[model samples]
Target: MRRAMTDQLSGRLVEGGHRLDVRVYFEDTDFSGVVYHARYLHFLERGRTDFLRLHGIGHRALMDGAFGEPMAFAVRRMEIEFLRPARIDDVLQVETRTALLGGARVVLDQRILRDGEVLVEAAVKVAVISPDGRPRRMPPAVAERLGAPAS
Candidate 1:
């Protein structure tokens, strides 16, 4: 309870159905002076990772399992829109929403914002897989915690 309250106040952790903010760095930009298109993908990935972390899902644990098999998630598809441009040192925020949760897939809606302006938007699809790269069902406990599958 106390930890929850603190995280809420500090903005390091978010509540259920929440948004997390992240800043953009020079390394995220390209020689063209604007954020590279691929950089947006990185931002979205971080947003999803943070969302899961805040919800107590340790990605490392999933990857480095006790059975010596590295569980992983792979991006299967993405639809992105570049609404605006972002530059070096821009303090951008990646807003993430859990759009869908499935037995073997997760979909995320993410937006990169700068001072209330949308720079980019994306819908990303990810599939969970075993070390051998075979699709796997998401753990029941994790699924229950993330709420029902998107219908």
Candidate 2:
């Protein structure tokens, strides 16, 4: 029987960050046959989500009040740099690292690279908020987990 693949199969923890492989499909490309600019955001977001998941935090669990309250991370700001274009069928690696952890926010450094060449880079700030949309301090457990590298 084939072994059941787990979340770790989708991505793996690296020395200083998390790495997820993303393939550029036709849907992700523009009329010019290159990856759409905004699609990089989706790739980066997936890396961030998986990074958190590998650290024992999940979107569903957080939304279900697993951390003592229903909360979610909302992107507060993002600065993106488009360095080069990626063609369809190209395999890209999305890297995510927690650059800073604060009471109510976490800053992430993310990059999309192809064959070790950076195609896109971004700095993202995400704020933890309650279900009602009010900013809230990150739970100690969540904060601690995010601050440490995944084992």
Best by lDDT: 2
Give the candidate number with the greatest TM-score.
2
Clashing residue pairs for model 2: none
How many pairs of residues collide in each model? 0, 0
lDDT of 1: 0.75
Per-candidate TM-scores read 0.80, 0.93
Whole-model lDDT per candidate: 0.75, 0.90
What lDDT is reached at residue 19 by model 2? 96
